[model samples]
Target: MKLVEVLHMNGGIGDISYANNSLVQRKAILMTKPIIEQAIRDLYCSLLPKNLCIADLGCSSGANTFLVVSELTKTIEKERKKHGFQSPEFHYLFNDLPSNDFNTIFQSLGEFEHDLRKQFGEGFGPCFFSGVSGSFYTRLFSSKSLHFVHSSYSVHWLSQVPNLIEKNKGNIYMSSTSPPSVIKAYYKQYEKDFSIFLKYRSEELMKGGKMVLTFLGRESEDPSSKEGCYIWELLGIALNELVIEGLIEEEKVDSFNIPNYTASPAEVKYLVDKEGSFTINKLETTRVHWNYASNTNNENIYNNGGYNLSRAIRAVAEPLLVSQFDPKLMDLVFQKYEEIVSDCMSKEKTEFINVTVSMTRNN
Candidate 1:
């Protein structure tokens, strides 16, 4: 799959749309709220600019993007009062790949602004949001134009699939069976792309500008740790079942690998230092469980959890899977995938290591 062309969350508010199925991402957003609020407060307390600019990089299509914008509005209101001045007009930029359902987020702006007005009592500064289309792996804005930047559940994705996965047969992502060379290839790609990301962002941010980033990461140095690889491991098993049943070919499975990687905290700090653009003020991890569907937590909920997980995975992975496997087998593939996921979750806890880092642009 062309990462630029098809790497978007399912669009629209339909049942399968990312707007509906993005609860996991929403959780990540909530976890970062305090960190983001604190950064924005500090920026206003120090810089005290009459006009402020902020960008949400890799902001997929969902209400959570508005949630970030809304909370920032609140933070600006509080900071303005505490600092004895009116808040600056906010220029908000929401960025994602070109294929992202930007319109889903864009369509909600009228409502977002209205709610902000109601909460801020109509005395708020004018806020404008624009959808910018591009990869975050390269420059997206002008030099020294932004004050605070935030990203959630992104930055782990590579610009493209690592080129040396020819030996990573029958696995869609990093698996135990993947050789050391395959892992090396993926990490090397991450190092190059992320270094470029930092260089560009450093140029775009004003002195002392702050950024908050949160995404999937691992606790162990091993990239194939349970936190990083188990999801894909089970997914690989699901695909192999289909292969056994003659639903999909083994060659197709061998050819696909997700353009994403999970790093340990040490790896992350190493990259930050290597890039030489930002100082890591705080790096932390939170464990979130994708257990029984919270909306329905019963014996049956375990089954529901698997279904929800499948849909969530489907929403993101369909583009890649469909591009390779026949569209006719989509339902069957996921049905079997759901069952396997359900059985596995019942046997053990399914969790992710969510990594968050707060950084300051070097002066």
Candidate 2:
């Protein structure tokens, strides 16, 4: 498949499948709330703005945006009371890609409008909320207009496919055998993306402002290990099946690759420090289990809201599997995934799939 085709397929699959799921939403909320609350407190205590302006970059649809806004409002109120100061007016900017589902976010906000007015009273404090659609890497706000910025589970995404992947003549991302050339190209792309991200964020953020972000990361530098991402391996197996069925050419399937960039905490710190605009205040990496058994008692099978390892495997494989494989074959693929997970569970544990990093823009 063409690179663009692969990107479209993967992006669509992620949005419809993983991004919209309730299990991921619940886990994201729990993991992010505390960090957001603390960041708000720090922003308020440090800046003490009578009118606070905050921006949430990559604030996708559904409960995620509301969860962040709710926590922020509570933090602002709490800090105001603790400092014996009047509540400040809040101006919030919720941003995401232009293609994101803004309707859902807007609908949720509309439902809470009455409640918000009741709590703060009509014009008790100026509350302005606007939705901005654009790439976060470029200018999204007026100069020095923001006091706090928050982004979660979004930065790892590259603005575009890495240039190296585009340039590679041979199998860039996919090969039956580990190819050093492909790995080098992937890292070069990641480096370029990371640098661009740092520069963009530095330009947008005001002095002493703060940003909190979380993304998928790797624990080891080793590229061959499953520690980087088991999901990729699972998808590879499904893709091989598609090749056998001749839905996609074997060469194309072999050339297909997942563009994942994982930076260690130390590496991240170096990048930020070199940018000369941010200081790493706190960085912590934690493991979040995306797959869990619906019933803790069911040892033989795993299910969570009808999404288990089998379901997840299928979701990732659907791009290559749909036209190629029949329903029965698809079922067999899921069964195979179940066996893989079962064997994995028997031998070891699954944890630490995501990384959370928090930083402050230097004055």
Candidate 3:
């Protein structure tokens, strides 16, 4: 699959749109807010330039996108209030794949800017917004332009599917049924892509700039662990059900694969160390139930959790699924998806491991 051409969240404000279904990502950001705040707080502010350039990579359209910036501004304000110093002017850039809905974000800018002015008041210096469209794997800024950079739930997406895995059938991602070779292909991809990501950020970031990143992660070094990608396993199961019903061709399903990967914490550290550009300041992991709800009655839990979980997954996977399967079958696919999730949730715990890291660009 051509990831840059096809990979994007479902768009606009419909029931299945990313805007409505990104609670899990939103919660993940909030859960890790402290890491972001500390990264900003400990930036050795004595050396910052007069203009503070900030960038949010993979800043898919929605309220969460601006919330990331708002939090940064708040952290900056907090530092000024606590240390009795003034903050530099802010220049904010929101970036995502070219296929992302920049219109949705730009339309909200008036309100977004107003909110910032209301929160920070008249003293807030020249906070600017520019929508940048491209993959973060490539350098998106001039050298020494950025003081802080943040990306959430994005690095796990590989630039493209591993070629060797073209022979692997049935599974769209790493699974228990995958061969040792398939596992290695994914590992290799993550290692290379992550290395480039670090390298580019290192070049663009001014010396002593901070980067805070988060993505889906696994608990074990073994790539076959479902801890990071069980949701894809369930998605594969859903697609197979469509085949069994004769609604789609088995070969079509076999020809499809998700252009994504989940890295283990060890792999993340290894690439960062090998790249030798950034010093790791904080690397931490957290988990949230796939359903994203911990307390509820069994009936509400089973019904609401399964349905909502399927919707959330749909928002992320629908674009890829439609490219391979009949677009008309999306409704049926997620219907079966909900059933599969309901059955799976009742049988076992369904949670996802998320890794968040903080680093400083070396001098």
> Pick by lDDT: which candidate is best?
3
lDDT, model 1: 0.84
Once fitted onto the true fold, the runs of candidate 3 whose alpha carbons sit more than 4 angstroms away are 293-302
Off by over 4 Å in 2: 1-22, 115-126, 165-177, 292-301, 304-306, 309-347
| Candidate 3 minimal-lDDT segment of 10 residues | 293-302
Whole-model lDDT, candidate 2?
0.63
lDDT of each: 0.84, 0.63, 0.85
lDDT order, best first, reads: 3, 1, 2
| For every candidate, C-alpha RMSD to the true structure in Å | 1.6, 4.7, 1.9
Off by more than 4 A, model 1: 292-294, 297-303
Clashes of 3: 0
TM-score of 2: 0.79
Provide the global lDDT of candidate 3 against the true structure: 0.85
State which candidate, 2 or 3, has the greater TM-score: 3
